[model samples]
Target: MSDTPELPWPVPDERFRHWAGQFADMHHLVRDLVIPLGLPQAAESVLTTARELIRMSYFRYEFMMIGAGTSIIAIEAALADRYGKGNLAGYLKKAHADGHLTKEQYDLLDSFGRPIRNKYAHGDLTHVALTPPLAIGMLRTAITLLAELHATPSPGPSAGGN
Candidate 1:
C-alpha cells in the first residue's frame, strides 16, 4: 500500500481557509460572469483554455528564467515532468541525436530559460506583461501538438478487429 497521508477532504490545506473561501467566491463570480456571455462549444472552449494555459505558462517560464539568472536546470526538470517523459525535446533528441537542436535555436532557448527560471523559483508575479506575439506562437505550437497527438493511432485495435 502507499504511504500517502489520508485527509478529511480530498484537497488538504488547513492554513488557507479564508483564501480558499475567497477563491471559491471568485470562481463563482467568474462562472456567473461568463455564463451570460454565451460561450462557444465545450470542445472549443477546452482548446481555447489549453492554448491560454500554454501561453501563460511560457510567459511565466520566461519571467522566471530572467529574474533568477540561474536554476535553469531545475526549471527544465520541472517542465520535463509537466511535458511528460516523451516531450518534444526528448523525442526530437532521440530522433536525431547529434542533430536534435540547431546551434542558434538551442542558444536562444538557453537564453530564454535563465530569467524564466528565476520568476518560477521566487514566486514573483510583478513582471507579467502578455506579449501578443509570444502568445500567438505558444498557442499555435500547443494546437499543433494537440492535433498531432489526436491524429496518432492508439495502441488498441478497433472493437471488431483481431
Candidate 2:
C-alpha cells in the first residue's frame, strides 16, 4: 500500500480548473461583495484584496500539494518527507500565516476547480464521483478560510495598533 494518501481527486486540467474556479468565486465574492461592504480605506482596500488573493492562492498550493504529495507517495510507499500528503493543512495554515503566496498562485489554483476533477484524477470516488454539493462545500470552506485569514490583522505597522 502506498504510504501517501491517494489523491482525493485527480490532476486533470478540467478538475484543476473546477477547483480553481470555486476558489476564484470566493475571491470574487470578497472583491465584489465583501470589499464594497467592508468599505475599507483605499490604502487598506488593496491590502484586503491582496489578503483575499493570498487565501485564494493557498487553495492552489493545496491542490498542487495534493498532487505532489500523491506523486511523492507514488515514488515511495512511505512518505520520505514529513511534509507529505498528511501535512497539507499545516502547509496551508503556515502559508496563510507567513503571507508568502502571491495573487498569481491563488489564480492558478482557482483554475483547477472542475466537477469530478478529483474523482477522475485521483480515482477516489467510485460511482458517486465529485458531486456539485461537495464542490460547493469545498468552495465554501475556501471562502471561509480565506475570510478568516483576512479577518486578523497582520503583524505589521497596524497589527494591534491604535
Q: What is the C-alpha RMSD of each candidate to the true structure, in Å?
A: 13.6, 16.1
Q: Which residue segments of model 2 deviate by more than 4 Å?
A: 1-87, 92-128, 155-162
- TM-score per model over all chains: 0.31, 0.25
Runs in model 1 with CA error above 4 Å? 1-46, 50-122, 128-130, 154-162
lDDT of each: 0.35, 0.36
Candidate 1 lDDT trough over 10 residues, lowest sum? 29-38
Candidate 1, residue 52: the lDDT equals 36
- Which of the numbered candidates is closest to the native, going by highest TM-score? 1
